[model samples]
Target: MQRMAAIDPIAYGANRNHYDGAVTRLSPYLRHGVLSLKEVSEHVIALVPTPRSADKLLQELAWRDYYRRVLGERGDAVREDLEPYKTGYQPSDYADALPADFLAAQTGNDFVDATVRELHETGYLHNQGRMKIAAYVVHWRRVKWQAGAAWMYAHLLDGDLASNHLSWQWVASTFAAKPYLFNLDNLLRWTGGRFTGCDADGRSPFDASYDELNRRLFA
Candidate 1:
């Protein structure tokens, strides 16, 4: 309740339409051991029988296991910079790259501002939104992946260490060696303009057509 002020059905696990990212329901079950992997998988497989939704959901659970294993093996290296020797790479100071107002949803980039606003007010940003935000933070702002990942960890109630830390590394190009960048057109499409640049001054454009955005995004 403290992490995210409200629940977003769009980011919930029960919502089959949104099975991509943080679903904010596993924390309690994980705490109580009520939703063990075997039990949840058996229940899901039994219900749908050849269900892709079930498959996707199960894969996420597996991801949890994978992260735990990686943490076990690497330990301290998981969060610390892994670049070898001082000669290989220079540590990035991303503080200058990020605009204080922007990360706080104060910057006037209509698209990203809307995104930050949603994340701030609801404590939930969709999977695609997460990628976009990371791209902006790392590629655009040149901030360290660790910084953004830590911020997400602080706020997201369902934040998983493996998913959060490794995924941030992926976005920062530490793992992939290339930060992903999305255009405004693609952003509009993926999010269906649900949260987009509102106006020229970052006020709320809200002028979006779901069908059109989907068509463009898929095309």
Candidate 2:
């Protein structure tokens, strides 16, 4: 209740994607049924002068409900791919487990190494952190989405079958309209310069443009 009361929907909608954004941090409660989407939506809607002012925050809450509905409809299949890899690779081609470099937090990318350390130490990653790390694992490392999802699920405090697995599918282009990708500029922008998006060698695979990334990542 106290956390719910402290939510600032306007701030959340405006800046939720940054590394140090005003995220509500209510997922563990919401995931465990301590709070419902309806309740949170109602609280947020009441705070904003107009409903549109809270659309971003409300839309995110609705996503939780959407994932749950998909889970109910699909059952165990959510653990598997809902669609083919839009990245031009077959399911069998991807690795079955995370590579040792990632587990050791030595992925050669400073941003990713920091993200891995944060995930292990805190068990809670921001939405951007989750998406990018999953991107690194599934897309960059060419590992299977299930491998990355299971790795994260084992450590997340807010992990849920619907939310976690579905999200991994999205990043891997098995659920989303396109494969999610990011470059050095994206990391520098969202992270407030916290990570250089480069390794100690001062070079990065993510230093390329999106067109180049697509060409490199796909077949």
**Could you say which candidate leads in TM-score?**
2
C-alpha RMSD values across all candidates? 7.8, 0.9
Give the per-residue lDDT of model 2 (tens digit) for 1-219: 889988999899889999888899999999889998888899999999999999999999989999999999999999999998999899998999999999999877898899999989998999988999999898888999999999899899898999999999999999988899988888788899898888879998789999999999888
Clash totals for all models, in order?
Answer: 5, 0
Query: How well does model 2 score by local distance difference test?
Result: 0.91
Candidate 1 is scored at a TM of 0.68
Name the weakest run of 10 consecutive residues (lDDT summed) in model 1: 84-93
Cα TM-score per model: 0.68, 0.97
Model 2 stretches astray by more than 4 angstroms:
none
Cα lDDT of model 1 by residue, 1-219, tens digit: 332333232234454333243454554354245557666556655655364645566776687777768878887677865442121224544553356877777666766677777776776667777787876676556567787888777667557676778777776656554445565556666666465545556443234354543333221
